[model samples]
Target: MSSGGYKPVVNTVRHSITTVSKRKRSSISEPSNNHEPVVVHRPHTSLAPPGSSRKPSKSSRRRRRVRKERSSSSVDRQWVFSASNFRNLKDKLVLVSYNLLGVDNASNHMDLYYNILPQHLDWSRRKHLICKEISRYNATILCLQEVDRFDDLDSLLKNRGFQGVHKRRTGEASDGCSIFWKEKLFKLLHHEEIEFDRFGMRNNVAQLCVLEMNCEDPESKLCMQSSEQTCTSPRRLVVGNIHVLFNPKRGDIKLGQVRLLLEKAYKLSQEWGNIPVAIAGDLNSTPNSAIYDFVASADLDTRLHDRRQISGQSELDTKRSPFRNQHAVSASQTNEWSQEELQLATGGQATTHVRHQLMLNSAYAGVPGTLRTRDQCGEPLATTCHSRFQGTVDYIWHTKELVPVRVLETLPTDVLRRTGGLPSEKWGSDHLAIACELAFMGEGC
Candidate 1:
């Protein structure tokens, strides 16, 4: 582990990421097996200077690409979309997230070498391309994971009219999380890093930024309801950029990481006057995995025990059912759980002091049925496409206070199938970006 991966506190000044040599490989804490994270990608050997005269022959390049692509028969569909499902888009805030699959200077592991993706050879060009694509959305907020070069990316984003907040993993990994929002559209009120390495792992973290949104229409802002009098309150949102541990073998570690982030999120909402919240990042957990259930579902202690095993089947049912549970977890029910159950339900967990009255849901849940993918994991969306696993691992989750008005589909399945898992000719990384347009459900501007 190198000190190069560690970063400064949440700062307001815009900065660029400084490049380092291949001696630093890091990410959500490791070394003691205190946490588990899904595998990420980076270059195997040091890349040569960009302007070298030598070039591989077309045939040799093709052979290398073919070897890198592996199999694609299983990746028939990319994401679901229906042109006919029209949306009444108005007064909406668009949000997007992506995992760049970047390795810290030397963070990426896998002694068994694989062919390098498009960006592996030239990081500058990759940054330019990825930044260009991300800028096209002009989203209200953008969350990025595995950001090995934080200052560079943050400076790039700031120059594009967005201000960003970033935090590097404290432990082994150099790659961390960075979140940016339109400087003119929102004001950063408070920020901090929620560290989950309390068990001694320094890798996993959720960088929390509380932003007060600027609204043109006073009519659209939320109101403080009171028995005697009422007043208008600034509309705000809690945004988080987090990368979970990657070890698929340890579901418990994933749960612990998520719990730490969400608990902080829940607390921040209260500190920020209980504002609407939206979280985006690479969770590393699949939709059907126990970790997903721990996130998408509320009251995991009771629900999990009732099922007898850690199951994600209910998450699919809720997402598909005509009547999605829009209601928040009732306080009465939350109060019934004992302290022991709250602290050790799934063996040894943290205690979350209940949740906000508003319910949280994945923004993609609002997509019309006809426009969504039908796959084994419930949705036909595949966010991350590494050689070993290719399914959705990136997400944008929000409180019910905000409604999803529209969502952007990932790269077409055909394009993904041809490119194989990632670093395709069309997309920059293995994980495709996800975006959603959300509107305030409480008022009309």
Candidate 2:
């Protein structure tokens, strides 16, 4: 499929997904409403150097709450709220997931961002805006995707007490994923990178890191070593970062990439004494999608779905296209998988289903969504918005060992519409940043 094509338009109303950890599933009507497809064109890449001559003023910083009077100023004042009801918990850990729009990608895909102001597209200004937004969170862990300018980001974050590792994509793609942590908070024990092309999937990549907290207090150490432990063994966590493929037509590859990521997360968790795990990034799949179902349920019968519709992106184009008919045709055809794809995606024979061992849950689960900000699923109404598309594709999923305390708020659709799409003069990326505060179970959570 060409990189340039009409982008599918997602419906506004969506059903919420139940917590997969409880082995529950929620069913909803198949996508029946669709808007006109947005036309997109391929444009030449702009290879501009980083512009960092000027600095932003104090007023340029973001405000915690959104204001009714919107402006073209660099400061972002979007409404922010905790997921569901807010709770004050002790020893809470904050994790943030963001996809920093890559400099090269921004230039190459200018057509999709035509509605955005040109000044907002400048790498220099955007870099400052991105850093300022991140500083406000003061997150202990950050899982970032589409980070092409690692050195610049690292330098900015390093001063804020964060040390990070970056992994570039396997092919010509300039960006990949990065995992950063505050130096005083955690010690990195193990790190690994995943290049999906090696597994015959694609050029996309993922990062896994095992972090152990610093126990500086002598009394805390004694408590951990004592026969009566205060909490779980060793303050440790396993974090996974990934940027799944965006090609909606290649659901086979998407499933395979995610499967490998989960497998790796489980392996690392076991190796590190089955510690708590947090996986964050842009999965490029929507809530309640077949791929999402498999992620939540840890099992999927591939035969039940059409390979192309597995990600649910095709459903967004149902109005103008014959997606329903195509789905039926694809489902009836036999042998949809090649031996390589079958093994990579399902980790077994082409005729079998896919399953994973780790019991995972979305951090946003159990929270209620308002009509303007999220679906009943408690997921953001739209995490990414641009000229061609607007929908929720980013998430932070966690294992049962941790309990969610609060989650960062996502912007309402009306706010995004007012901005004329993202990477605007205010916000730095097309996607909104998601964050969650979590505490280890049985540790005063």
Candidate 3:
């Protein structure tokens, strides 16, 4: 497979498998509430006649049943608590994005400390700490970018109670992407890698897992058996995690990349039918930029909430109503507006609801100091740009079918260095991490 730049061969194979899997999985599951029979086809046998001798051996049958029982047992254990409750539904699904800085390579470093332990420590502490925080949310799936190699990432996550599948090859200069999940929550059915152009970078796109959600009511068993509800069976959901090119700063190139990503996602959504889809990464573009516009236009939801609006509303209305002047004006002039109306207009948007903002630098600066302190926790700060435009470029987007329950930006910190007695300025990576909570429409897609 091509590493840094695009390779047509890799793209073709990955796209083909993704398409085939989508069709096959849809065929196996029943249609949604719409009653549109979307059937995914499986491998069929070519027969010499109607009753040709092609029966499976007794040993093969036994193995198949044993495998099925093992797989079912694993899934059942993951949801046994919910099975016992039978009245409470799981509320949220979380997704996280982290950039694992370039892996430690001998050629890149000359000093022993920086060469041997720095890279290894950064990988072990920084990356795994980030992973631990993500796991706290009980995220069903995670999309990670800028991973050095499949083995390193897999080893790290596997050690931390998570299972992952890496789609890229090793020894390549630029790192590829990966998806890690709780083994109990998702089953890996298929995966592939896609390249953007004939000479562009090779990217990964995988149908990594299917999450089975437990039903709340015991009587609901009959509902699933009857197949009357659209999402009767708790099945799999499709997740596409990717990292696009950072150079060639032209709008058209970035827009084209966004289009390609969305096209792939749309195809998967069609094949997966009613399964909510999410695409997350460092798109390297701001929310107002054309690249972001192209992505938003594709109908895939993004987690870019406006921080300015969120903070302004929270401070002015929720706490103390910044509209005292408006209230006074209304009282003196006998205006038709009430205190609530004045507050609504002067305080900005409503405070009860916090919309998704593009967590940019400007937004971060505007956040209350207390909250900022809580987010940072006494770490040395690193700028996004060397001197200018230091803000959030990373983001998480979701499909309309999914609702964002909560979103947070993992603060950059020198905890690794400080705890290790190293300089406080040292950081694991250049970009901040973005995380979000999503409510799946049905049990599982």
Candidate 4:
């Protein structure tokens, strides 16, 4: 027989099966005569109770009704606080970003150095400090860059009672970005890691998270002391976390990478349909750099412009505000200050500095009252002389669909000590984590 003719005959025999149960017996029988096998169909009705109606019972009807109601209720609840519901998120969501300097394994004295480490000091310890700082602000979403491995971060958040979704490493610097959320509040739908060659270095872009906020009803009224109900604003928002390359040697390279990152984010936004996005991260370059322009020009519309409001310097008059020359300061000056110096001098407040060049080129400059800082913990050391000249290197940008209710930098003392400390054998990473909280106006993002 030809191959095709024999193939179908073999398949017909292979599909035959026979089973005998209390209620029924099923089988495929073949005739002794050299003819094709036949498939017989039979269904026993003995399983039915005596006099039972073939139609469903009243209780089954009730169950079906309840199941439908439950399914609809779940969808309504989800839609009630979708990304579109929240037009402004000043106090609803918080986003954080930090660089975890890769782990150093060169030390030979593993016993003394590694053993004394706190149980939490492992990846979990560092992630705990970060999550703890984030929890302080009640952050809903967090973005971390330069993660050594996905496992290290998973272990950290797992230990802290938090869950995270991360992308696989692509190239050199197996370094990647990840996002963690309060699982009780948000659900992750999709995640992917993107890599592109820029200049000569290989850079990575991680796009992860589809968040849903457990928001309060904006139209719902709160009962007043007099028994009358007053309307309250909506709560809940959606956000995106990103980490762009910072290496200045390859401006063109970084610019291209930024373009690719924005492309991916824009595609996600379209796929999500009407969902607002907040992109946060340690963009290696400040807002003034071309890379920032590339991101700002993407489908994302900047809801808040750059602002310089000094913290801890409340005692200092407006004339002494370190943020005064925020626009005038050069990239060189911003780089000269250490994270510790910026934290101490700002009185635990951090600044967001954009490129003066972009301000000069665009009409979006001079958005007043937009710039602000939050308090950092711990007292300044007397030996450290004066606080560092601080400016905004980190950032929080939002879409027009979402409004900014409150955006501030978070710098807890313990986090500062861990991130600002010089590269040491004990610490898991460098760079203080910056966090922000935003409130929604109508529906949750």
Show where candidate 4 strays beyond 4 Å: 1-91, 104-128, 159-161, 197-201, 214-239, 297-392, 410-429, 443-445
For model 3, the run of ten residues with the poorest summed lDDT: 75-84
TM-score, cand. 3 vs. native: 0.50
**What does candidate 1's lDDT look like per residue over 39-104, in tens digits?**
333444435676765566698567655533432222222222222232443445678898876754
Model 3 residue 46 distance off true place after TM-score fit, in angstroms = 91
Looking at model 1, which ten-residue stretch has the lowest summed lDDT? 1-10
Report the lDDT tens digits of candidate 4 across residue range 1-445.
0011111111111111222232333454654475444545578555578988576578855544333322222210000112123333333554555555434321322332331223323554555555455555555567776666668667656665457866534655556677787655555666666655322325556564556543333422211112253324223233455565544433334444544554556566667664556666655554443344544443221112211211111122335632221324233422233343333222223542212101111101111111111211111111000122232345555655444333332222222232222222222343545543444434322
Evaluated against the true structure, the overall lDDT of model 2 is 0.72
Candidate 4 minimal-lDDT segment of 10 residues = 377-386
Per-residue error (Å), model 3, residue 80: 29
Residue 199 lDDT in model 4?
A: 29
lDDT score for residue 126 of model 2: 85
Q: Compare candidates 1 and 2 on lDDT and give the better one.
A: 2
**Candidate 3 error regions (>4 Å):** 1-91, 104-125, 169-174, 199-231, 299-389, 410-427, 442-445
**lDDT accuracy of residue 385 in candidate 1:** 54
- TM-scores for every candidate against the unseen true structure: 0.66, 0.76, 0.50, 0.48
